[model samples]
Target: MKKENNLDKITRKEAISKMGKYAALTAIGTFVVLNPLKAAQSSTPPDDTGGNPFD
Candidate 1:
């Protein structure tokens, strides 16, 4: 079996901080990819969807 790295272990607080950073990064990535369309939409009034998305 291979040995684990003792040098790279993180504390619980560090892990939690890293989780928050990752979540924020993911949110920022999604927003960046979606921002162009959102900006355009915000510049215009929304059209009626016939009261239903399936309509």
Candidate 2:
């Protein structure tokens, strides 16, 4: 039978740190991937021509 190794044992602090790091990395990755596309999208312009979809 194989025994558990010391390295496999994780302490409370290590677990918390790992979770925080993972959350930060995930946030950064999402921002890095989506921010550019969001910035490139054009905002709604004012309709000076006075035309409405209902009209």
Candidate 3:
């Protein structure tokens, strides 16, 4: 009687797929870390007096 472990078995297709996914994730992470987006800053907001001009 012989016992085989399925967890130790990996196909070539699966390995390539996993490698590609990891590569894509790494690239995206690198890009985000290197060049981050900055939020727009406003110096001052418009004033609202709430007064009617016809009054």
The Cα error of candidate 1 at residue 18, in Å, is 0.8
Query: Model 3, residue 38: displacement in angstroms?
Result: 12
Scored by CA lDDT, what does every candidate get? Answer: 0.92, 0.89, 0.81
Whichever of 1 and 3 has more TM-score, that candidate is 3
lDDT (10s digit) by residue, model 1, range 1-55 = 9999988999999999999999999999999999998898889677876676775
Q: Which stretches in model 1 have alpha-carbon errors above 4 Å?
A: 1-5, 40-55
Clashing pairs in 3: none
lDDT of 1: 0.92
Cα lDDT for residue 35, model 2?
Answer: 91
Top candidate, metric lDDT: 1
Q: What would the TM-scores of all predictions be?
A: 0.53, 0.61, 0.55
| Poorly placed runs, candidate 2 (over 4 Å) | 1-4, 43-55
Clashes of each: 0, 0, 0
TM-score ranking of the models = 2, 3, 1
- Name the better of 2 and 3 by TM-score: 2
The C-alpha local distance difference test score for the whole of candidate 2 amounts to 0.89
Give residue 11's lDDT in candidate 2 (0 to 100): 98
